[model samples]
Target: MRVLFTTWSSPSHLYPLVPMAWACRAAGHEVRFAGMPSAVPGIVGAGLTATAVGSDEELTGMSASGKLAAWHKQEQWPADWPEHPDRLSPAQVELLAALGRKQCVIAERMVDDLVAVVERWRPDLIVSDVSTFAGAVAGAVAGIPVVAQLWGSPGVLRYENRALGEEPLPEYAALFARFGLDAPVDPAALLDPCPPSMNLGSALPRLPMRFVPYNSAGEVPSWADDPAVRPRVCVTWGVTAAKVLGAAGLEPLRRIVTAVAGLGAEPVVAVTAAQRELLPALPDGTRVVESMPLQLLLPHCDAIVHQGGAGTALTAAAYGVPQLVVPQRPAPMLLADRLAATGAGRTLPHHVVAGDEHADKLVADALDALLTDPAHRDAAVRLAEENAAQPSPAELVPALAALAAR
Candidate 1:
């Protein structure tokens, strides 16, 4: 079987699907990754066969300014949902559906190239990251089955076929016709990595896979292997936030670092090389380094403070490390909500921690609660156990094969 794996250009988004792609390859299926030129390197770096499908427009002279927050809206974030889209009012549904289209707009640029790839490669199956709509359309055009997988919360699930008041989102509906195919708003399957305790009930049937942490390749710092006598707290804001917020990310990172340091815990900040200057002067015992493998860092951590990227939060949860999430986007906010409810961590709104006068105190309080409380660690361990029990990506290969055969 030949399988095509598609993702938009974010490493965070692509990382979640890598394990499953590897599983397919390990099972003797030919797996090829297709995406924008920006995404091809990460795919190739992971040792997968990569086919670049579309060119990212350098058309605009802006350094990093295309669709900065497609699905990162604060209001549209699942602020209040009982895991049911039916619970929302018509107005809310319409509004959210619009945001959902914006979330998927990247696919519009890639569909033509993606469809051409499908025509040439003629894969038996196409598996895509949840946000990669072009692959679904291409699969529909190619008459091959497509399965969508999630890295985190179901931001897209809430808007499936939802009306937009007088102006509804005809995204997939119109999108399919544009390619001369009838698009099924839903996919053949939805794969999720969140533990059952953390997962909101999925409206669509879900295939749960254990999230194996995969950071393409990074050297483990010498300090990571050594144990610390004091409590070690890892602070990270993730790459998306740095790109979206630019120099402004410093304020939030300051609060996170300051709060953790105030507790006398040794703070290890993982940042990008460019992000190093943006960091505020650190407290005496804090160490800031660019690009440390999170999987290596998390196990040695007593607790982690992060902006809620699914990869970051899930990795921490998988390691049974208690987390304190300062959410930059709605998805992280949603993830934070689940973690807090599950007793594995705590969540603070970005505003509370970003330049608010009380930000330092508030963050310190949350960190203290996570640190001294045995319940947080116990719950994290429980979630880790649940995460481990989920079928591994390698184990999910037969199921994918069956889906394709069906």
Candidate 2:
């Protein structure tokens, strides 16, 4: 079988699809990852064939002008929003619609190029990031089946479906019309990597797959081999959070490092080369490591402090490492909340991080609890067990092939 995986240009969006793509290849299925030029390096870095489709200029401009970050900025959800997605207020509906529109704009930019790729490749199936509507459209146009892969717990899709109905958004409708298609085609299946314990409900038929942490290949730092004398806490802001949140984004990460240091734990601050340039000097004895994959570094650590990203959170959970999540955006906030509910971690909201003068102390306190609390450790271990019990990506390949064959 020929499986083509597609996602937007962002690392967070692309990384989640890596393990499954690899699974297909390991199962003797040929695979290729298609994306905008910005995503090409990441695709290649993951040891997959890369098919660059659309230009990166528009997204680059959006990032430079802060529009991309603005689009990600989400205020706290209403008290009832999470539990009752279908009964959202008008403003909540608009919020989902606005985000859908933004995503559609990105999809619109790539659909034509993606369709061209589909026509040329004639793939047996399409696997896409749940939010990458372009892949869905391209699959529909080419009469191919698509499997939507969720990054974490299902959130955006549920809200979008409730708020906007099954019809395509105006932008999506325009894209469909361009190819003479009448309506958007739904994915044949949804692949959810989130552990069932953390899963928020979804109406779509879901196939649960274990979350395999893949943060691209990198050289393992020599220090990682040494035994930790004290609790080692990893602090990371992911690859795109700083770009999305701008300069202000580093503040929470900085505070997390400080708090971890103050707790007498060794703070292992993982950063990209670009992020390293923008970060200020850390406290004495802080171990700043660059380009190290979290899967390699996380197993050595006792706790993790990060901006709540699905990959980061799930990676930490898979290792049974207690987490202190400082969520900066809406999606992260939701994941953080879920993590807390499961007793595996705690959340320090963006507002508290920005508004509280005692934010550092609060962070320090949270780190202290994560390191000292046995209940947290026990819960985290249970979560890891739950994740381990799920069907591995390799196990899912035959099911996906079966879907495509049908």
Candidate 3:
């Protein structure tokens, strides 16, 4: 069988779909990844076939100028977002509607090009990132079965449902009509990577796919290879957070480093060169490297302190490393709540973050609690056991092939 995978232009969006594509290829099936022009290089670099489509000059330009992150940070709800999503304030409803509208704009950019590719390729199965509705539009036009890969946050989908009745999606009804489909969009299945304890209790059809960490590739260093003499903790932030918080975002990450360093455990701060520029000083015994493959680093760590990006959080869970989630954005708070539920971690509210007058002390206190407590470590092990039971992406391929055949 031939499979075509499509995703949004962002690295956060594209990286989630990579392991699954590799799984399909290893199964002796032909696979191709299609994305907007800016995303194709990443797809090709990952050793997958790249089919570039559409243009991301506008989104790319916004990111380069830091306008996109600033926009996202303003609408971000911190703590109350996990409240009953069905009954939200008009302002909250408006925020959800605005998010959907923006996605539709991005979707519009790719759908036409995606449809053109689908027509020419005519693959047996179509797999797409849940947020990338362009792939759904194209697969519908091509009359093939489509599966939505949930990078698996129930909070995200739960948040998405708020905008459902308010809009018909993409605000481009003509395209559905152009493709001869009656509904705006639909998928045959949703492959979710989140554990049940963490997922939103929605009615959408869901299939299980274990969370796998695929942090962008980096060269391994000699220091990383050496076994640590004491408990090692990782302090880091995702790219989205840096962009959203701008220079101030580094404050939260830096605070995490100082807090963890004082706890007598080793703190490894993984940052890119661009990110390192914002740092003022490093705490004693705290090592700050430009960056490293997180999957390689987490296995040796006792704990992780982060801004609660799903990729990093899920990766930490997979390795059974206890974590302190100092969430800076709306979505990370939800992920932090779910991680806290597992007893593997604790989520800090926005009040304890960068804007707080005593942010550093509060973070240090949290880090101390995570290290001194044994329960967090025990719970992390249990969560890891639970994930180990889920079928990996490779295990799910035959089922996908069966679905395609049906």
Candidate 4:
């Protein structure tokens, strides 16, 4: 069988689909990943066949201007938008509509190219990141099955769609009409990697798969082998935050490093090369490593302090490490809340991290709790066990094949 995997241009989005793609390949199926040109490097880096479908210039320009980051700020959104969708004021409804239009615009740019690829390649199945609407369109156009893959979030997009009464925005409806297809072609199945305890209930036909962390591979540092004289804490703000939010994003990193240091724990700052140059001077004893994958770093650490990215939070949970999440956006905030509810982690809102006069003390206090508390560790271990118990990607290959065969 030929399988086409699709996602948007972000590596975080692409990474979640890799394990399943690899599973298909191991089962002797032909696989190709389609995305914007910017995603090619990540697709290739994961050792998958790449099929670049659309231009990256628009996304690149948005990131450079910080417009993309600005859209992600949680403060601009109504606090009750998720729970109280019916009670939304006119302005709040407009805000939600605007966000939907933005997504539709991005989806529109890729649909033509994705549809063309579907016609030429004629894959039996298309596995897509949950946010990649173009994949659903292409699958509908070609009359093939599409499987939606979640990136360890609590199905936020699904929740939002339900809240919106499952109606497509006008922009989305127009995009579908252009191709002579119906709006909102539901996927045949959802491949969820989030553990059952961490997952919010979803009405979709869900297939539980283990999250095998595949943040691009890197060389393990020599220091990683040495025994720690003090408790080692991993501090990271993830790749997207620093690039989109600029200096404002790095400020939390500074506070986290200070907080870890103040508590007499070693701060292992994991960063990209660009982020390394932008960071301010750190206190002595801080170990700064560039381009190191968290999978390699998290196992040895006592705890983690980071931006509440799904990949980071889930990876730490898989390793059974306690977490202190400093979240800037609603998605991450939701992930942090869910993680905290599981008794495995805690959340610190970006407002408090950036605005509190004693932000370092607050962070220190939280990090200190994660380090000293035995309950956090015990809960983390249980979460890890639950994660490990899910069906492996290899086990799910037959189910996917059956869907395509149907």
What C-alpha lDDT values do all the predictions have? 0.78, 0.83, 0.76, 0.83
- The residue pairs that clash in candidate 2, if any, are none
Q: Stretches of candidate 4 above 4 Å error?
A: 60-70, 76-84, 87-94, 159-164
Ranking of models by TM-score: 2, 4, 3, 1
The predicted structure with the larger lDDT, 1 or 3, is 1
Kindly list the per-residue Cα lDDT of model 1 for residues 161-181, writing each as its tens digit: 454222325775676789666
- Model 1: per-residue Cα lDDT at residue 275: 79
Residue 394 error, candidate 4, Å: 0.9
Off by over 4 Å in 3: 60-83, 155-167, 170-175, 178-180
By TM-score, the better pick of 1 and 3 is 3
Q: What C-alpha lDDT, on a 0 to 100 scale, does residue 373 get in candidate 1?
A: 93
Enumerate residue pairs that collide in model 4.
none
Candidate 4 per-residue C-alpha lDDT over 280-345 given as tens digits, one digit per residue, 9 for 90 to 100: 778899999898989999989999988888988889988999999988776687688878988999
Runs in model 2 with CA error above 4 Å? 60-73, 79-83, 86-89, 155-165
> Candidate 2: how large is its RMSD?
2.1
Per-residue lDDT of candidate 3, residues 5-42 (tens digit): 99986577787898899999999999999998888878
Encode model 2's per-residue lDDT on 1-406: one tens digit a residue: 9999999865888999999999999999999999988899999999999988876666644543433345355566643255565666676676666667667778878888999999998999999998888898899999999999998753435423436466556776777778899877788999999988777765668899999999888877777889889999999988766665556668677777887888899999999988888887688999888888899999999999888889999999999999988876656877888888899999887668766899988988888999999999999999999999999999999999999999
Q: Model 1: runs farther than 4 Å from truth?
A: 58-95, 154-160, 163-168
